[model samples]
Target: MGIRYVSYRVVLLITKKLGLLKNKFPTKPKQSTFITLADWKDTKAKFLIESREKLNFPKTPNKKLKEETLRILNGEICFFSYDWKNIGLDYNWITNPDTNYEYDIHLHWTDIPDFKKENGDIKYVWEKSRFAFLLKIIRFDYHFEQDNSEFVFTQIESWIDKNPINQGPNWVCSQEISLRTFNWLYALYFYQNSNALTEERFQKIMYVIYWSLQHVYNHINFSRIAVRNNHAITETLFLAISQNLFPFFNESRKWSEIGTKYFEQEIDYQIYKDGTFLQFSMNYHRVVVQLLTFGIALKEIHNQKFSKVVYDKAYKSVQFLFECMQDENGFLPNYGANDGALFFPLNEYDFRNYKPQLNTLHKLLTNENLIVNDDVYDDENWFLSNIKFENNYVPLKRTYGIFSFDFGGYYLARKQNSFTFIRCGKHKDRPSHADNLHLDVWVKGENVLLDSGSYKYNTSEKNSNYFTGTSGHNTVSLNHASQMLKGSRFIWFYWSQAQKAMWQETENEYVFEGIISAFQYLNPKTIHKRKVTVSKNEELWNVVDEVSFANTDSMQQNWHYNSDKIQFHTIELQNDIESYNSSYYGLKEKGEGISFSFNKNITTQIKYVEE
Candidate 1:
């Protein structure tokens, strides 16, 4: 680290210890009072109210969606795929249902202890506070032609009554606050015409929105400077878009201006030129895509324009994710740290499916669909687009070849029914996982040799280390240690850098070769070089791994696979072990994998076979 960055960190630590950061974000004023929309001089609330008519919501209820909505109505809240039954239909906003750990609602958000030291994960408490389920309920009500505004408004009122401004775990994260504020706005627009949306209710909701925006604005520097990733993008985009929806607020114009500036800057900084996100996670990248969708769509509605760089980055982002996609199902390789965050899920698709969000942005940018298939994912498009929903799509012609994103350090080898994905990157920003030189293979829409998904961010040391370490990926780890030195949570001492990477395609086969400087903590000379070759006609792959080091004698090569389909051919598989695979957050299943130990080099052949 440079002395400048070291000094910045030291200064931030001192300021935090001195309660300077807390002083910037003040508590809600005791005399804070709600004002009706009619009382505002310049209000765009009517535009939002009338915008509901343009929404192309599903006319009939989806059975599964209705079931989930009913469960939520019956006091069951789904947290990271686990249903916590009877979390109270009104909902307890400050309690972790998993551990029954209730946070002190009276304490300032800055006073909350880190979840690692506490009994439960703070995310579990923040989940319900995100108010994502309210969007689900609103969608359900729209589909069934039923008015659940009374219930929805009651829930919002209950949350406000419980969580004071700048207090409790819900207020700790600016990103979470942004998400909650947006979700509330979504519900408010959908229920604007309801008799249940009385003047009193509107005043209360708008008051909370005003305060939430202020909170995010005040704490914006925290995300921008310290946590410069998706969190920064989310919070900044929230402030930018909130200006359009809630112009009646006093600081809306100034907030939106600064928000627009930083939002664009963040997009340029965090989203690389090739559209791979700085965070290096498929799910986190999708989060930015959704934020882009929101920013672009909302700006268009208000007849505003962001800089051309914004559109350029959005286009590149769409193309990057599209190239990584395995098939029409929109599943990408679970290649990086995934906390299972889907900021705006407007469709009924699985969390891994990227078609809805990706296609939405692609259409917004180019007026053409990225996926020309029969699978319809128009929910997001309907919500974001001004035009009515239509199944007709002018498919954008995309040429698929060996695609390499040099800036983001991703290489893709495309064949008829399979593609090989590799990650070798120099970290201009903080890398999420120590997974340089990791490889993922997909055959016929199924991941044959896969990257083990991130299970959870905060967990037991062994689990956390396993999921984030190089051992969980299809790569070579020297001395059974990660390629980079793990520091604290989400921190690495020495970042692995890609020394050399290349991709080539001939008439018969596609090839990729990459080398990364690794394990500087052990020896600066340590390096891991990997080469992959895929046959054009046959479902076969060859991976050669070479590790050079000063002191280490043995290097371990790991591969995770769907044991039912993939078969190994060249290398002898030793230490066949059962591992945990978590495709979704808060969920893991037993998976099979094997490791090969070699002194200096090893070669492995993987082939897909019929079950």
Candidate 2:
């Protein structure tokens, strides 16, 4: 290994060691403190004991937005569809809700009279039911829509009775607890004026929030990673929200103080200087945006203000969200870990469309409108309702040009009818996928070549590896091996480094040239180079791959692409290349791919004729 490679290894090892030893977060609590509330006399936590008035969710002002929200509320059996397969939820059981919760969650979605489970895994069902609590709150608050207050309270009562303090699947993860606590608090506020919210019921709900907060307090360390990414932000946002909204307890003050500090710290740390998320996954980036937007909205409604740095990073983050969209309908390049997590699924758009979030963030920060085609998006109604509205400001500007984010390792060449996004950078933070030098190409708003999204986090080991491997991306792979060495399911032993080595353009044609070290999983002396040239009209494109190695015999190089939007048999290939691709997670489709055997160089040309 060269001195540079050795230095990289040493840095990573030292980083891991420091992460393991870091312990600034709260220590795990004992059973005795599981349900305990802070003492009022504790001056250190005095702010938590102050009174907090409830805030209202935004009422629909735009007719189009209102109708959509009402349609979803009335038409669907469930307010939100948790399953992407369009499966119906079995409110009686948590499993698939449509089918059943996972075997381990040990809890049901609804309050079944005889729900029994010998073993429970809390992480399985808690994430699904997270919005369930908020849905109940909405149902009761909009009484004209539907008053399921009794059912909602019964479900809460059953959940409290079934899942004891710090026991079973529900209490297993502090992050889940933190999320649930935030939702439960909102539900309480939404239903505060309802007859169903009795004094006894209110206390029970408060007790649940208190207990959940305690769990989060005990396990805060789990959220505080060396990178301090979204997990840590979620925990801190929950703490800050809890402090501001549920200031009935004595601990709220300390939580507010510390949580706000960490919130700002994470905003500064987890968000890159270029406004990209540190995780480098578009979906996780969206999650961070949602968390930041929600935190900022909550504080704004309560008259709590973060520093200008927090607000500025948030605005730039939203700007990045807008810039990263690859299509007209707002579909982002599914270039990273995607768990089908939509923080607020108020709108019925596909998970890939990020406009809802982008518009929401725009409205929150600027106090101006973005003139979205529709107003009643779930995110819009939810977030806009929290803050006061101002003059209409439309910022959705479309342009055909080149955009480069060096820090994020993304280069985009866009035209009125085409887009080419290239990924050619090494990770400054831990990478979630083995994709290096991946390219996402789109024509006429349809993706011609793309990244296969993460289907499931946990499945058969082979399937999980397939979706995350280098082969799943639109890139060249060596001997059917990933560019990086897989360590654990989500980690790579060594990261590949790729850079935009050259870029050239003429009136009718543009070229993007890049190179990546593919030696991590192959011969240490091998290097792979790629050059892509396309016409301004997007009618013709050429890709050239060159491999430099001391010994080329018996080495295999392959390139993959997607054919979902196009007929596979129609495309002309300059070389006798085979094809393979994937549509969803954990699944692969037979498509054309190029392969070279013991060759130093190969070139492929793709021509697009008018249909």
Candidate 3:
């Protein structure tokens, strides 16, 4: 049988078995069951496509975090921490849901505080690990006092036993926060020995460990789902493997088989062949690095040999991480608000060292070349390639036919001295940017046709005109319609691919051409041709689209360019529009190729590293 048929059948079988095809991708996840208490409002989410959109100072906000950690340590949050059991519960009933799911409810980041209002304004957000890590510091600062032991147990029990809790739902078995609870319960049972054991606690501990292993470490469907990368998914994978905690859960033979099953397929979802993970956020990339460290430590502790696939993938993935790291305004672009606690001191240590992006890790290297130490940062791309239309996707069968093209743009070093990039794609997608096939080049660091990035997610009403829709990007705006697939879910999902992205050299100029399929409704035989040329002599670039939508009407197209700085350009439209942009930062021009310019001298060179 042909590899395509065989490979396709494999995916088809898996999806069929999982029943995933039957389930429509949710516009928003049902959080009442998984995350919080209620559905969010348009007041909160501010789905921005309505506005052309109008559009951060951070210097290791770590010092303030350290101070708070110290306060929690001194027992300040709970006045006089003498066995919190005595204190009547001020906060109770996380929720008393009518629906039922039996929950042991071991809290993972329970140490952190929830959303709080201060001085008539919402200030500190209740993020998962950041606040939780601080709480652990507070507890440690007290030196594990004997008097406070009751307080910890009572509070943890009350907190954990709440009606609603968060852990991926694999409801076939009992619904318990099995992973974190295992650690919590294990820590207490073996506090004296600092190791979880004893014949009595063994079986129960095994059950929890079994659940953790099944979710991320198993071959079944339970492992496929993910939140942000820092949702502690990677940490869950490593906790079992690195702790040599396997025997306590399952036997040696069974453990090895299951362990191999967990990673080989699952890792593909995280690390692309180019070494990038699906989630584009930088903080998550950092999380992946730490996970790799734990994975290595795991192999040694368990004395098990990982498959060559896992070893080879991890090594190559590090290369991808280093390539994506850059010096934006000094820190990685805050693509989206990321809230995770530092595994170490942030001011003094570079988190990148945890899985340092050097060509190879050395025995002699002491500290890491911090994300801060790296001279480049890209506000444009949060991760390597946010959402990819890639072929040559995997499996040796069709590697030759495999092609990877991104609507999301990339950062390139021109002549190895300056940085220029193209920004396409959004971890969140929109229908109204001119940046569909838009190429924004910053030859030697100048704001050329660029991506007009988002304004705000929290405060929507006013900023809407500036951040949402076609005018925010650099693509050709056909009518007021967007080039993207619309609706809120479109912001998060895609259904098609870009084909024939051939990169070639014509002695002095660089050439790239591909066909972008809007990923619309998956009707067969639909194609849109896009071509981009960057000339060495012109020191200029031109992008053209001969896009033909097959049997579809009123489709919109746009190109977007995002940057820290805004560009001043007049929209000299040759084609007339029904109406101009209703909001700011958008255009209403409808037609074929449109040229928007930035009067500046720049250089964009395209060269490839020999594989």
Candidate 4:
């Protein structure tokens, strides 16, 4: 219907010109510090403004919105989102709450931050001591120095308490990290099942802060992409509209001045000016440093104001989340941290931020006077400061004109990952084990070629087909099971309709590369050809493909490497026949996505002027 009302009003005018709505922030009292609260009673805030005026939903009004935007751009649907799945990909099943979760065995213990560290960074000290042992064994009710004084709970909890009172996606958050980790661990087990009362734990913490603002304002603010989505879940949804949806009611100064002007324009346009969080990641800067250490411990237990430009922009976003860590192995760099969820120190390698309340903050991404042992990372004045945290930053790439099989773009740009992006995208009538324009390197910020993530989809889907192909991606592949899009690709519709990228960076000495195309269903008369070489004697980085297809002939150039951490060092061919030296396999994830392969026809070799 007029291209789905011009693609849902061009994605709400690019999320209202990218400030992504907090109603668009900046109310001033000297640009805010939030404390003003003069009075606020506790009447249970009409259990969330009468459940946000009974949210009737169905707003296709304006004359039934051009026949409901041609029944949602011809993919017709109505009543409560049709068979949904566009990007929600089940969105991590509310913390994968055991549908009888199975496993024969996979153990490798010792981690309370590596029992006390030796050389750290074995993947952030085994996932920050296995997420502090899955939040001390499924959150709340604790005690066990080898067993004693009872207080139990935890079967691997925290998908915001298996999120549901309004369907799931982990029941999205807000209201200050849904009152400290998923509706205060389910309203502190409904105030210890009503026994520990202070008015029954403040009326089950105002019914879990009015059911987390009717499940994040009925999902309109689950932040589909607004208010930069997760800055410690929008500061625990503005600490649940300032400590339990504003002192639990009595009209509460006209809905707490319209939810404090939509959380002061969603923390100044979802935070920036150097608070760094345009969606970049260091495991989401530890959820924006525990949501600014729980709003600095709820402004010391009850003075909640939050201004000083939101406490110096959440203390320069915890010093840009420890200066976006990277030194080959100081750890952290995965750009988008997305593996199975339930994070309670399963082990990434003795996670270290260095104590003494993170020593006022100067992290530079760990090394705080040594401890980790195995992967060996000692700091000895490693602080190296001039303030240039190796910024190559890169985000302004935005072009997307073609790719669902019609060649590529007139030119290209195809940027990737802005914070934690990786729906693992795809296309071609709708293909997707994911590989459109195929990108995966990051450089200096670390990540040499990754994407080989997903493992067990069914016998680990053929060893995760080298991270779903085009030879695991840095672009150009004419063989090795082809692949650009087909089955399993998340629905994009437009996140740049599946690949057509372009890049440049060179004064000379060869650093530039190209992709300008990717996306095909049928259309090939000759080969496809590809190249990305760099090895002036082991600098290591190569891939070249040349295919020919009028009637297929002689072509076999497979160069796959699965182990030995990658050490081939050399290989070149112009026209040959027999070739064998296999070593390719995938599915060793923590943050998967690593690929490299060049085997097909042949006709791509360039040095041009300064090799």
Candidate 5:
């Protein structure tokens, strides 16, 4: 780290600390003066009163979607692909369903810790408050022509009555507050004409919205300066859109100006020139894509325009994720942190499938489709688009090739039915995982050699160490230790730097070679250099890992795979071990792996065939 960067970080830390001190004495919003729908019509804000008529849904309700919606209506909440049933009709907004622990609702937001010191992960409490599932409920009503407005508004009232502004766990993070605010706005716009939206309920909802936006606006610096990643993007974009949607608010104009400027700047800074996200996580990238879809679609509807760089970066982002996508089912490599976040779930696809979000953005950008097949996911497109939804099948503009995203440190060797993804990068920003030089291979839509995904952020020390450390990745580790020294909670002491990284492609084969300076805590001169060769015709991969100047007693090579499917050669498999593989958050399954100790170098070959 340079002195200048370190000094900047220190300044940010001090600023955030001072902000928190100010937050210790918080004030609440007073009663709201009622405004009717006619009053809103008089304002210059773009009232989406026609959204219900503009949206085009499927002819019939999806059975599976109906079932899930019914389950939610029955008081069951789905978190991280698991259902917590019997949550009761009056669901407490500040309680962790998993641990049955209720956070003190009277405490100020700043007093609440991110992780509870005693019982559970605070994310459990924050998940339902995100209001993502409420969007699902509204979709149900919209698709089935069911009058669930009473149920929906009742629940919204329940949440508001429970979680007061600037109080309890629900108000802890500004990003979560932004998501909740966005989702509520969606519901409000959809049900604006319904009889269930009485004047009394409208005043109550607007009061909450006004105060919530105030909280996010006041604490925007925490995300913009201290944590300059997707959080900043989400919160800033919310403010930008809210300006046009709710122009009646006092701070709407100023918030819109600042929000639009920073939101565009964040898109340029966080997404690399080659379209890879700085966070290095596939799920988080998808989150950004969804946010972009929301922002761009709304701007296009209102005939507003962002800077050209925003659209250019959005197009490049779609292209990059398109290259990484495995198939039409939209399974990308679980390469980085997987928190199982699907910001807008308008269709009944699996959580891991990303085609819906990607296809929506592509259509919004070019007025064309990225994937043309039998399956249709036009719910999100319909809600966001000004014109009616149409499935105009067009051929994909970009084809597969041996591509290198140098800025983001990802290289890909893609064929008709196979993909080889390699990670070798120097961190200009914070990295989520110690996964430098990690290799992810997929064949025929099956991940043959894979990454042990992040199970959960708040886990045991051993599990946290394994999931975020080098052992969880398919790479070489010195003395069975992580590639970099782990610090307190998402901090690394020594950042890994990649050197001499290059990719080459010939008529028959693709080759990649990279060197990463790692494990300096063990020895100052330790280095791990890796070379990968892929034969196009033979469907084979050969990896050679070499370690130099390592003073450790032993070096180990780790590989995780589905033992029943993949065939490994050119190396002796010793010390068969049981490892955990988590394709989604808060879930894990035991998998098989091999740990081979070598003096300084090792080689392995992998091949997959149809059964």
Candidate 6:
């Protein structure tokens, strides 16, 4: 390991030690009092006294959704084609759901299974089977246009009975708990007027929420440093929303205040000044936007507010997402780490269809129409029905050839119907993918060259490595190795640094060049420089890659393309060593593109024209 790697580990150790110390110092001392008989009786009697009032649902009645709601109620639940029940897990509700769960006796939390072991077979099942998302049943109420109080109550009660406090797989991560609490709160809000929300059921749900928040309060520091990405933001969002919306408990104000402070800071800290998220994943960026929407909505409801910086960051983040959006197809380029987390699946569109999220967040922020597909009623009905879409979308005016988001480290070259996105910058935080100078190209609405998005975070060791490797992206690789060395499953030891050397546009064409030497950490340093030229009038594009290395005979360079989309085009390669592309995760399709063997220098050219 290099000095940088060693220093990083040392800093990590120190931060973790400090986190441990902070854990011991609670914001307030825990209370010693227990629920007394009189208190229980009073709460029970108050809850039991039925008020003859109709529960107000968040969404207005839509008869068109009855069929879908009925299907969900009939157990035709959809979780990205993987249903929980089909995974063969028992539903006893009195014990740990994962039969193979092994609790860490000392830590008081169930240990996560090694995803690399068993060829990532166990984690594949467990990650999908974790019933945390089962709470999506609340969306059914939106469909039926009525509250399913009993259904929501039973689900929570059963979950609580099965997964004791900090003992099961669901209890392992405060992030998951926070998400569940948010969804549960949604259910309560939607079904507040239901008679099924009896005193007992309401109290039980409150107790569960209390337990979840307590776990978060105890482990906040861990989320602060180790998983300081979106996980920390989500936990704080839960604290803010819960403490603000459900303020009956004595700790609510404290929770709200702390949550708001951290959340506002994170908005500025995690999201860059130019609107790009630090995590570098488009999907994770959407998650942050979703949480922002939820948190902002709750704050509005509770008559609370965040600082102008938080709101400004949120607005810019939404605009970034809006710009990154693809043509009318609703699918943004699958760039960056994607773990298939469709947070708040309050819509019927495909998980990859980010239109719902973009539209929802845009409306939430500006109260002006961004892009409204009539088919996006589900997300709008649930989150932004109050906002009016008065303005119709006018086509975005083109601003000549090349546009670069300097702060985001992305360059967009557009000509008529073609667009290219080049990623070249040192990440602001931990990078989940080892892609440096990666390019994503699109023709009109189709993906011609794509960044085969991250498939799974934890599958087999080889797959986990391959999916995140530089070879999996449309970039240059040296010595058949990634641009940077892998530090762990989700980190690179030596982060690659990239800089734009040239960006010039002429009357007929646009030219862009970037230099990146991420492989300097290797013994004999190597550098790769790439230049892209696109003709404005012609439907043609070209790329040239030049490399400088000591042992050219031992080096390999490649240019990858989306094999699935390449079906519509013809590929010509000169001086290519080798080429292959995987259509999906864990499945590589060979002989799909060009790869090259180097001899001190190599030149490559590709022409893509619409058929």
Q: What tens digits encode model 4's per-residue C-alpha lDDT throughout 200-249?
A: 23343344445444334434343423333453345334534444435534
What does candidate 3 score in Cα RMSD to the true structure? Answer: 15.2
* Candidate 3, 522-581: lDDT as tens digits: 335555565556565444455555545544443333433333232322333232222222
Candidate 5 residue spans exceeding 4 A from truth: 1-20, 23-25, 41-44, 47-58, 81-84, 387-398, 571-573
Q: Write the per-residue lDDT of candidate 2 for residues 1-611, one digit (tens) a residue.
A: 34554565575557546753223222232323222223321321212111112334434343433444343344232312333232222232234332244443343211121123322222235554464435433633352355556655665666666565654456555666676665555455455456776766665666777767766765565466533568888887887766666567678788878788877888888787777777778887888887877777777666678877787777778777677675567877878877655555555555567878877777777765444566325566555564654323345466766766667677777887777777877677777787767777777766777776676555556655667887677666666677778775467867777744556788887888888776555666677788878778755667777778724344344445554333222122224444444333333456655444545665666654456
Task: Name the candidate that leads on lDDT.
Answer: 5
lDDT of 3: 0.35
Candidate 2 least-lDDT 10 residues: 43-52
Instruction: Tell me the TM-score of model 5.
Output: 0.94
Off by over 4 Å in 1: 1-5, 32-35, 38-60, 81-86, 373-375, 387-398, 571-573
Off by over 4 Å in 4: 5-134, 137-187, 190-197, 221-340, 343-562, 565-611
Clashes of each: 0, 22, 54, 71, 0, 9
User: If scored against the real structure, what TM-score would every candidate get?
Assistant: 0.94, 0.79, 0.51, 0.28, 0.94, 0.82
Q: What TM-score would you give candidate 1 relative to the actual structure?
A: 0.94
lDDT of 6 at 54: 32
Q: Could you tell me which residue pairs clash in candidate 5? A: none
Writing each residue's lDDT as its tens digit, candidate 6 over 31-130 gives 3333332353344221111221332334444543454455455544343323233222234432222344443322334334434333343333334323
Q: Residue 557 of candidate 6: its Cα lDDT?
A: 51
Candidate 1's residue-wise lDDT over 1-611, tens digit each?
Answer: 45555676788789889999778766775544545644542344432223345566446567877888888888887776443457876557887776788888888888887565464678888877788888778777767766788888898888888988788778889999899887887777677667777777777777778888989998888788878889999999988876687766778889999999999999998888888888898989988988887777777767777888888888888888988886657799988888778776565677788888887877777766677653445445444545333222334455666888999999998777887899999988888888998889888788777888888777888887888898888898787889888888888888999989998888888888999898998999988889899888888888998888736877788888875778776554477855778888877788888888888888888888775
Candidate no. 6 TM-score: 0.82
Q: Give the winner by TM-score: 2 or 5.
A: 5
Residue 590 CA displacement from its true place in model 3, Å:
25
> Candidate 1 at 476: error in angstroms?
0.6
